[model samples]
Target: MAASFQVISKLLGRLSPSISHPLRQYLSCLQRLPVGSRPGLSPFVPPSRSLCKAALPRDEDAAQATEARLCYKDSPWDYLESEDYIEKYGTNPVWESYRRNHKGGIPPQKTRKTCIRGDKICGNPCPVCRDPNIIIHHQNVKLLQQFISPHTGMVLDPTRTGVCMKQQKKLHEAINTAKNHGFLPFQIPFVEFSGADYSNSHDAVGSTPPPQSLTSGETWYKWYSEITPDENEVAKVKKTYKAYLK
Candidate 1:
C-alpha cells in the first residue's frame, strides 16, 4: 500500500504541480485518519450538555416552612398566636388586609363561589382560602372571632370580608357550632315581655260556656249554619287547585 501510494504521488507530481500538490495533501490526510473510519463520514463528538439536569436548590427553611404549615393545619388556632402570624398579620383580622381585584371603580356584588376547584386554584383566593394555615373548625374560636362583627355579634358578610361563598358557608357553620357549644356568645334580640300573653284573661284563652245541646243533623255553631260559600268562588277555587282537590 505504501509503494502504490508513492508511485501514484510521483505520477501525479510529474503530470501537474498544482493538481498533484492538492491530491498529495488529500491522500496524506486520508492515510493519517484512523483505520476503521470511512472517507465521507465525520467524527462523532458527544454533546456538551450533561446526561442529567442540574439539581434545584433545597433549603432547610423550605422543610421547616412545610412542617410549620402542617402543624397549623392540625391546630389552626395556634397559628393565630404564632410569631409568624404576628409578623404577617399583626393584630388585625385575616380579612382586614385583603382587597378583592376588580375591573372598574365599583367592586363586585358578591365574592367568588370558591377559591379552589379540585387541584386548580384561582389567582386571588379569599382570606380563608389563600392561607393554608387558616382551617375552618368549630374549635378555632379565635380565628372565627375575626369574621364576626363586634357590635352586631353577627358573621360579617362575604362581600365586606372578601370571603368566597364556600368559605363563608364554612364560617357560618363553625360560628353556629361555636355559639351552640357556648364557646361564643349567642345573640338574642331584646323583647319586652307582655303580662297579657301569660294571663288567661283574653277572650281566646277564657273558659268557654257549656256547649248547647244540638240535634245530630244540626251544626254546633250558628256561624257554621250561616256559612254560605258562593258557588262561583267555590268552583273557581276547585278549578285553581284541580290537581290537589280530591
Candidate 2:
C-alpha cells in the first residue's frame, strides 16, 4: 500500500498541474475499488515465486539412501565409551546446562511427578527426565555414579538432584540393577562384629538333622505356619493336570 501511494505521489508531483488533479482523482477512485476488483489482479493467482523453494534437484531414491536418521540413543555406558559425550558434557549430564537457567531460589526436592505429557515437555524438567537421549542402562556405570553419593554410598535425594519422581524411580531401579550386575558397587553400612556375636551358641553348634528324616518341611529352624493349599483349588488343579499326570 505504501509503495503504491509513493509511486502515485511521485507521478502527481511530476505531472502538469491540470493533469495532476484529474490523475489524482482517478487514482483515488482506483484505491477505493474493492481490493480484488483491480483490472489485472485476481485472488486465484498463485504466488509462484514465493511458493517455490530453491534446491538442487536430486533423485528421490538417492536422497532417501543418504538422508540421516535421528539416532541419539546413547546408553549410560555409551557416555563413557564415546568421546562425543565427553566433548559435549565433559563430566556433566545433558541437563546440567539446562538447570543453570533456573530463575530463582533452589529447586524443589522432587520436581513434578512427570515432566512430559503426550508430545509436550514441561518448562523445567528434572535433569534425568529432560533429555530423551540419555538412557539409563545397568551397564552405564559412569552415568549411575553421578547420582550416587561417594561418601555416603547412597543415591542422592531427588530434592538435591532436582529429579522428578518418575525419573527418580527409574534412577533407583537402574542403580539397583547396575549394582546387581556389578557395573556399580553396592553400598552397605559397615558394621563392626564382635567375637561374642558369632560365639558358639547351642543352636549354632547343634548338628543338622539327617536329610532323609527331615524331608520337605517349613524352615530349618524357624517354624512358621504351613501354607496349606485350598481343597477346592487343589481339586481344580488336579482336574486341570489329570490328563498330563497319566
Candidate 3:
C-alpha cells in the first residue's frame, strides 16, 4: 500500500507546479511523511485467506460431508442403520426423549424461526437451533426420520416435533431429495378410477349413433320426433294451477 502511494507521489511531484494549491500541499505532506506512513491513515494489514474462509458459511457439499463424519460418532444410528440404532436408542427413537419441564401452562407448539440474530444467539435455544454444527443433509436419514412418521410414512408436523418452520422446511426438502436418491420409499397417495370413466360410451362423448336408430327407422334421439303432450294430463295440470298459469 505504501509503495502504491510512493508511485502516486512521484507522479504528482513532476506535475506539482501546474496542479492546484491544495494538491501541491498534499504532495508536500506525503514527501515530509515517513516511508510507510500516510496522512490521516491507519496501518494496513491483509487478512489471512484461512481466516477469511473460516468467516464464510460452509458450502452444501462440505456441510454434508462434515455432518456425515460427525454422525459416525455424534448420532447413535449412523443415519438410519439398524445396528447402530439398536446400540444407541435400543428399541426407542430419538423423539421419545422429550424435555418436559417448562415454565408456561402450555408448552410452545414449535421452536423459533432462527436462534442467532446478527451473530448473537439467545439463551437456552431449541435443540435444532442450539448447535451451529448440526447440518440438514439428504443422506442424514436418521435425523430426517425423526421429523417423519414411522407408521404413517408422513412428515411429522412442526408443532408436534417442536421444530422451527425454517428447519422444518429444510427437513422436508432433504427428505424429498433423499427419497429421489433412493434412500427412502416415496409414499404417494393412492388413487382409484371408476371403470366407466375410461370408456367413451356416453352420448356427449361417444362416436357411435343410437343403438337401433339405423335398424328401426327411428330418430337417433327420441326427443327429435314430433312431440305432443297428453291432452287430458296437460289440461288437468293447467287447471290445478289455473290462477298462477293465467
lDDT by residue (1-246, candidate 1, tens digit) is: 557668877788787777788878877987798767636422324554444333222456678889998888778889889998899999999999999999999998998999899999999999988988889999999999999889989898898999999999999999999989999987689899899979987889988878788888899777898889999999999999999977
Judge candidate 2 at residue 18 and give its lDDT. 94
Collision pairs in model 1: none
lDDT of 2 by residue, 1-246 (tens): 647767867968898999899868866776888877755423427776653443324455446434311243533455455665678677775545655235468654446788888889877677766655467776767777888888888988776677778888888999889788888876577899998777776567767756544547556555345566789999999999999986
Residue 22's lDDT in candidate 3: 61
Give the Å shift of residue 101 in candidate 2: 8.0
Weakest 10 consecutive residues of candidate 2 by summed lDDT:
65-74
Lowest lDDT block of 10, candidate 1 = 48-57
Tens digit of per-residue lDDT, candidate 3, span 1-246: 557667766767677576745665766677787866755433334655867787566676678756665766455334446454456556554545545335788877656776567878757554566544345788777677777887898998765665667777888899999999998776678899998878888777889764662656677777877787799999999999999984
Better of 1 and 3 by lDDT: 1
lDDT of 3 at 117: 75
Q: Global lDDT of each model?
A: 0.86, 0.69, 0.67
Backbone clashes counted, model 2:
2
Measured by TM-score, how close is model 2 to the native structure? 0.50
How far residue 152's Cα lies from its native spot in candidate 2, in Å, is 1.5
